[model samples]
Target: MPRFAANLSMLYPQHDFLDRFAAAAADGFEAVEYLFPYDYSTQELRARLSDNGLVQALFNAPPGDWAAGERGIASLPGREAEFRDGIHQALEYAAVLGNDRIHVMAGLLPDEALRGKHQAVYQENLAFAAAEAAKAGITVLIEPINTRDMPGFFLNRQDQAHAIREAVGASNLKVQFDFYHCQIVEGDVSTTLRRDFANVGHIQIASVPERHEPNLGELNYANLFNLIDSLGYSGWVGCEYRPKGDTHEGLAWLRQWKAQQA
Candidate 1:
């Protein structure tokens, strides 16, 4: 069975951010992931994970000025220093939290003409991140988010991401494949997964179009989960979806999926 990690940023919205750790654990999640851990101290976050017996599966390196709409700085020219600082900060938190993977978001790019320049910057930044992270025994990740959801997101296609990984040529740098984004950007998700499985370092799931629980989507998660298991993927599959109703009520899918494995 594929291990599932509750995405605390999207799940357990009823509780406070810090409290979501306990809620996810109570619901039988062995691991948890969130967008950023910068808001809380490492000690507080680590205590929550230790207390709940939850593994810190994944979290993002700082995205520049989230309130200012800067999704990430790695792909943005002139922000390289800030981006490097963010990576260092993220690594500090990862060390304390016992996390081995970090996702680096590609910021918005409104200018089509600047694509080449941005791609160059992104690749260079990723190379830098990978080298720094490798020293800490950590892997850096890049995710391709759908344009509809994040209109200007730099990375959008699976092939594009893999190509960037190849160009970067960093062994510890890999793709963070999200099914929701894959389905939105490229319809043939399973085929893409199979083709890009070797370069994939992490996985995530959500319903198509609505980004709800996995069971409600156009995608048949059962088959996907089985495929992942068959591929011998042992990494955590992040449940990165918002609940349509109560979070606990929406978890019937997870419960059912786990039961099937039993």
Candidate 2:
């Protein structure tokens, strides 16, 4: 079955975290994903998932200074301690929620004083984090945010993600390929996906032009998903889009469109 994860951040912005979680389960979604679940207790969140019979698919590892507009700092210099602490905190939540992967958003670059020395530190920290994640049976993912969409992000291209994965040298470290961002930054999504199939770990999408529901967007999700299925991808597909109205009302497109995929 193709698991659908309601992006609580965009889908149910108006609802409390757990309420939307319950709603996702009620709507027949077997899995759920959230951008940041730091505000809720893993135990309490886990209980809700259990009661609703939903799988915890994925969650963020924490992007530092979300409020200060700092974006993230995983690869930034002199902040290795902060970065590792964030990963540890994320494991606690992910372990409780039964989530296997963590998205580590690459934060903004540090001051030029540390520029030459910082990237080495970033790679080393990633290797350490990956090793730790492997011990916990959890995989750590690095997502590249396109500069066109989100400027000042450290990793803004697939090549950067690929380099990080290669440097980590751990099976547990992989790249998160968000199609919407990839399409905007670099077209030919299928070719890039196929080329990096081994290293690409997770995917998220909204749509072009509107960044809303899938069927209304330009990208042919049916063909895209067909390609994914043909690749024997058994992983989940995250419905990480903004709902036009209530999240539930926007989701009717899911059942309405996928049925035609047959």
Candidate 3:
């Protein structure tokens, strides 16, 4: 069976950020992830994980000026220094948290006409981040986000992420496969996983169209989980969804899914 991680940022909005750690543990999640951990001290975050017996699975590097609508600095031509600084911060946190992977978000292109230039910058930034992370035994992940959720997200397709990873040539560089996004951008989740499973660093899931619990979606997560196991994927599958109701109440799928896996 695949190990699961609750996305604290999206999963436990009912509780304060720091308190979500215990809530996830109480509900049976052995691992957890979130958007960014910069707001909290590493010591405090580490204490929460230790107290809850939870493993820090993954987190994204700093996305510049989140309130200013800048999703990430990476891939932005003039923000290379800021991007690198964010990478260093991410690595520092991961080291303290014992996390093994970090997603490098490619910032949105200011204009479609700048695709070529932005692509080059993204590749370079990923290469730099991957190489730096490799020294610490950490994998750097790139995810393909659907434009509907993030309208101008620079990386919007599985092929695009794969190509960038290939061009970067960093052994530790890998794709963060999110089924919800894939279903929106490209419908062949299983086929794509089969072909690129070796290069995948992490996987995430949420219901498509509505982005809710897996049981409420068009995708058959039960089968998909089985396929992932059959494909020999041992990485964490993050529950990156917004609950339609109480977060704990919405976890029936996870509970039932675990029963089925058993």
| Candidate 2 whole-model C-alpha lDDT, 0 to 1 | 0.80
lDDT of 1: 0.95
Instruction: List runs of model 3 lying over 4 Å from the truth.
Output: none
Q: Which runs in model 1 stand beyond 4 Å of their true positions?
A: none
Ranked by lDDT from best down, the candidates are 1, 3, 2
Give the C-alpha miss distance for residue 197 in model 1, angstroms.
0.1
| lDDT per residue (tens digit) for residues 1-262 in model 3 | 9899999999889799999999999999999999999999999999999999999999999999999999887889989998999999999999999999999899888899999999888988998999899999999999999999999999988888899999999999999999999999999899998889899999999998899999987999888988999999888999999999999999999899888767
Q: Could you tell me the C-alpha RMSD of candidate 1 in Å?
A: 0.6
Ranking by TM-score: 1, 3, 2
> Could you give candidate 2's per-residue lDDT for residues 117-163 as a string of tens digits?
65677688788788879889998888888777677677778877898
Colliding residue pairs in candidate 3: none
| Prediction 1 TM-score vs. true | 0.99
lDDT of each prediction vs. the true structure?
Answer: 0.95, 0.80, 0.94
lDDT of 2 at 210: 73
Alpha carbon lDDT at 87, candidate 2? 89
For model 3, the run of ten residues with the poorest summed lDDT: 253-262
**RMSD list, candidates in order:** 0.6, 1.9, 0.7
